[model samples]
Target: MHDAGDAVSLLRDGVVLLGFGLVFVLLFRRLGLGATLGYLVAGAVVGPHVLGLVGDAESKIGVAELGITLLLFIVGLELNPSRLWRMKQEIFGLGLLQVVLCGIAISAVVLFATHSSVAAALALGLPLALSSTAQVLPMLQSAGRMRTPFGERAFSILLFQDLSIVPLITIVAVMSRNPADANGPPGWLLFIYTVLAVGGLIVAGRFILRPLFRIIGNMGEREMFVFAGLFTVIASAAIMEALGLSTALGAFVAGVMLADSPYRHELEADVEPFRSILLGLFFLAIGMMLDLHAIAERPLFVAGMALALIATKALIIFGIGMAFRMPWRGALALGLLLSQGGEFGFVLFAQAQNALLIKPEAASLFGAIITLSMATTPFLMTITRRIRAQPVDSSDREGPVADGANALIVGYGRFGQTVAQMLIAQGIPVTLIDTDIEMIDVASGFGAKVYYGDGTRLDLLRQAGAAEAELIMFCTDGDQLSAELIDGVHESFPKAAIFVRAFDRRSLLKLKDAHVDGVVREVMESAVKMARLAMKSIGIDDSEINRSEEHYRARDKERLKAQYETGDLRAARDRIITQDARPDTGLGGGGK
Candidate 1:
């Protein structure tokens, strides 16, 4: 009876917490502030310091920290050996420099300013060197630059940063001030454990995890994958916990082991929801745990520290990017994009507090500074848009040549495959571009080379030789194109005739003002063909079928024109004909 009562209480508490989270998250998202901030705000409002609607923040955080574990797992899944090797130069070279330099620089600043011990400065500053991957990746994706060179470079740094968390944890553990940590394994022994553990995970991934997933997949029981995914993460974390190691590291190892598996995406999809919810919960708990009074007492300290952190990291990163031969604008953009403190700072702050290297009040003050730094990113990018938008000097580099490819197809999906094949069937020189990593791998297996990048960007288009190509086909799905973009392409490459694949009427209407050579509705022709088949099965004569299709084609064209003119899909609804022109058209006009 007590257990049942406790369950009911838990449910009610969940409802209230989620209700607060949803409201604030939606509000913040609408205002262009990220969901992380929203969760923090909600948690603070409902916390003991404010409305006191919730309590036991420390207990809540212990559970919510699983979100961090799950997040690490997903990050590991992204680092497949092949992808890692492909971006090795950027990931290792530039990424290593960014983390090391920024970490050292920030540590020195913390050491000198706060007069903290070397260990304490490292615990605080190393984490600050990392940027918010969660915030930055979505921004890149939304801008359709996720596969661009600049975006990829940014991602490389972020990936290394995520990878750095493990060693950072080890460092924190090494500097533990708690007597409780004294009984733990020594540093060298811990390194051995790390190696043996990683090897075991890889072996498990190849034998145990893969076979289990395959069996579940073959059974077509998708729900089981979710169960299995959670089991894998929890089991790995449990293994580490039993060994008195970092549980998050265990989950990360599990993820990396499965990164190259066929079921990577499925596992990610299954586990993403739980990760998101728990992560939100984690932030909420952090918010509740935040020492508002500490921040209030040291407002000047908070503001000054935030500014110093952002400026120091940005300047350091900008120099590294330039040293790596990035264009000035690209380097500047990279700096600004990654200038903010990340969520992991909070995680490390807790670690520092636990290690007894930093007081809880110091952690809270730094946490507030990190949060403030995060809030400034969106505004900073908005202000520096023009400076980063400047064209790179062509004389500093050799220009991209089309290599005599007459047609450049922007997408290499099903639609693109057909178009490219038809063009190739006619013996036309062709180049294919795409953003889907899995699709690119599959296409490569079939001996088709698909260059990976967002095809919608004018800069990427130019880099792909859009200026020299005779035809540029945008066969990408959905409404990713715009008149302004089309005009830019046209203005840049006068010789290239542009053709676009419109997903629907709305997309077509949106592109109505663009001076493109052609626009093909993706499903219109196939839908018309199927409709004709239906008419033919019902015994309509060839002439009647032709007339019906022609009528629909004509009416649709007229309706589309009207709708496009008025900028409304509902403008020409009356033009749809319910009654046919054929009088008493009988089935087969007399049974064949």
Candidate 2:
């Protein structure tokens, strides 16, 4: 039986994670590295194999799994099926070929070096077939590359990796020692099982989960909702495992099915904390699994192998990216981002150990190598940033210029595209300024007068016709830049009507304070539609509903002003939404 002191020690273990996490975050910031790398390095320090600060906890694996689940779930939320179909050439065509070529090439090299069977070589190769979706996406998002062409290409590749894992793992499972590896489950039987599991999941995910969630939501219990989220993951995983498939694959499929659900955001919000904690725990467990004692004794061998792994993978990716017509800097970033082995490699290695396909010592060595590779990513990204910031040739800046039209759209992102296309269809003269080179090319192909330039710079805006323009629309995501553009426009072109898209009420208030003529709330538009629907259902005339909505909108403006002054508009927004739902609430009664 465990002693009371053991219980106390266990209680203290959680505290150590907090202390280590903070020091790591601060030190990484001081070192000019991102906080994510710090968190990973901190896990290494606190792991049982390192400083012995905290021993491995099996429950932490669940935490890490949760992290991956939430990470992929959020990714699914961002993806639009229509957008994916449009990018199928790069995603399926280019991406599929890259995975096949890379996997085969890497497997051959690894098999030759290790004298491993084809199964073992293929298992090892599969890990490198995937790039780090988590690392790449966040880096692109931070560098404002998420809206760029390179970003879209990277996303397509990442999506392919996500989908490929299912087939790759299935192959691995088949190749690895089943009691009858020569005569495994019949192909037809396996196919039928996979089909049935996937179909049932889709049916349940669509019809059953929605009604279940709606019932739970009506109960208004936050904890219950969180429980339901967990239930979904566990239940899906169980069904998949019963059919001899991966739990990760099951979780991913469940997420894809729920991607269009209204409750997705709520589900994500509810699950994120659990996911983060688990992923951290997963990293910590990885740290504990590393054989640091062996590394200390064989530092030269470990270092050499790490260098070779990184160098070879980098060269392959860089070469392929260049061949695909990626600009030098973009190729450099892609190569660096993918140079390392990922957590998935560790997962595959562990499975190989269970199958007795790889020696335990060999698995340990591979695991350490995989961990080291993941740890090196942030360092590489930091270096890549420096490379990107280097001076470029003037001749390389060749691109078509935006026409000096009466109206200028300073951004060509999703929201900007919608507004721009509508205006163009009406024959209103418009020019677009966007920093994304790919977006500029795409928009120009569709007959838009678009140029690549940093819109935040007033000089660029002036050159793009902001001064002579009848109107300037700010539809970008950058809060500070959008606000700055509004201020800049007021100073330079006081006669031009400045319209800006607001991410939320706070931003709208900020724009209003800047005396902007028009501000569109992203969520407010959706909320108004919902309000109109509810009112119509309750026997309110369409004309009266429109008037009521307008009155509420005016009331909301005043309320937002007060809330903004108080600097707690989130709470105020909630209150306002609640009040808007009540018939007796004192905003207004009828049509405009």
Candidate 3:
């Protein structure tokens, strides 16, 4: 371990990996290609097969495995039981269908070509069935589609795939077990043991985990808390390995158990850096493992196999989407998004090779094909976006909202829709204006009164009768656009009362400066409501909770106004703190 040559090699590998990774990531991003592809290219260039800068890709396997575990752990942290239940249809219905159908179809092809045993065919095909969650989710998020219908469907399918890995690992382990060893446990016994191990994990998570976290949290040492979180993940994984189950399953369960904890956010922040770096290393390892020699020998065969895999997956996914009644455009986009083989394929294939489920030669060829397919995903997604793009219709000039509406709503997005719905239910007439023509079209289809026009444009505002409206509400997502609208309306139509939706404290303060009649911080009220629930959970009385909330809200409002007026944030904060500390103050008690 202390050898100088070993240290030198390690240093050299690190240097080449990080150096090439940085350059490739920046370059690929500028060229509109994704980072995962960049990592692969970087690894390929500096690998032993190419430049010999980094020796023995196998040496990094253990580190790469940890990256996969951490990635699943983070995924589990983002999901809770309730959220899982909400998407049960997509997860169980569409997700299960996709895996089964794709696996069967691919396995049939593999069997026909190689005449392999069913188990071996399945071992190869199942991995191919899974799509890249790591790549697809981030791409959707960056494109502002994470909350769209297509994005939600893609996420549900991905979540199911992630969960499906546990069972796949168990199957591989079972298949790998030697039948000749009579001393080894029987199949039935092994199955019972697996069930027992899972039950034990559930019990431990429910009874033991929360209290342990509570004790750690009370210490007030952030580093200690971080250590505890890491320890929980690693130790859980170790226990699962000891019990002959997958480490990933254990990590996922532990993450879900802590998902509802107050410390969830802190734990996420603590583990994110480790997860990112390790995940990068995992991708790098895959790149280094690329068999350039195999590719060079049969480039045509490899290219054809890659294309077939993509086309097969894309066609199956598109068919599934159509069956589920998704719009053709959305279905096509989803197909392209999920056509690539997942990062999990590498892990599964390696495990299969070790288990003798497939020959090493076949595994190498398949691995190369998977890597090539992954590299094509970003480009395919760009094409899918083009196909899904909608043209704006500007021919409709009729006022969908009543011509004499009392309220003018800027931006008919999610927030604006909710506000408009509540007002409409109460018989309040509202005229909506938004820059997104697609959103306007969708809203109009739902019988909403929406106009396709930019709120920041004074000409459009006048056309929408903003001057005659009793109140102009700014519910647009963009702070700059909302600010511009606020200033324009205040200057041009002084009689119109202005209300705004602000994303954060800065936006709130800026809106106050613009002299809006009302400003609602996006999450402030919801946060207070959550705080009330927390207080109630801790046995605080209902009346006490209400009184405390009211007093705190009033004081906070006064303090915010003072902070804005005097422009002395520190002094204002200090005064509020001092006042709240006084026993005579109503805020210091449940009630006067």
Against the true structure, whose TM-score is highest?
Answer: 1
Q: Count the backbone clashes (under 3 Å) in each candidate.
A: 0, 4, 0
Error of 3 at 120 (Å): 3.1
Off by over 4 Å in 3: 112-117, 177-184, 260-263, 390-402, 406-408, 414-429, 435-448, 453-592
List, residue by residue over 1-592, the lDDT tens digit for candidate 2: 4798888886888788768877886786576444545566677788876788887545565456566655555555545577677998888865786677767777776787678888888887666667656556666787776766778777777777766766776777766675644354676787888888888888998899988989988999989988998788778877877766666667777777777777788888887887766666665555566667766776665555566667777777777788888878777777777776665665666667656677656665766665567667778777578785434334644332446677788788888999888988888888777777656667668776667677667777777777778888888875654455578778988767888888876676566557578888766888889989998898878877867777677778778777768756664554354534654544344112
Q: Rank the candidates by TM-score, best first.
A: 1, 3, 2
**Residues 387-466, candidate 3, lDDT per residue (tens digit)?**
77654545554433338888888878888988888988999888888777556666778887677766777777777787
Backbone steric clashes in candidate 2, count: 4
**Clash pairs detected, candidate 2:** 63-278, 63-279, 64-278, 64-279
What TM-score, computed on C-alpha atoms, does each candidate reach? 0.76, 0.68, 0.75
**lDDT per residue (tens digit) for residues 1-592 in model 1:** 9999988877876787899999999998887668888898889888887888888888889999999999999998998899999999999998899999999999998898899999999999999998988788887888777877888999999999999998888789889988888788887988888888878888988989999999999999999999999999999999888777888899999999899999999999999999999999999999888889889999999999999998998898899888989888889989988999998888998998999999998888888888899889888889999888754344532233456789999889899999999999999988888877557666879898777677788888888888889999999988989999999999998999999999988899889999899999999999999999998898878988887777778888889989988998898787776544333324234221
Alpha-carbon shift of residue 225 in model 1 (angstroms): 0.9
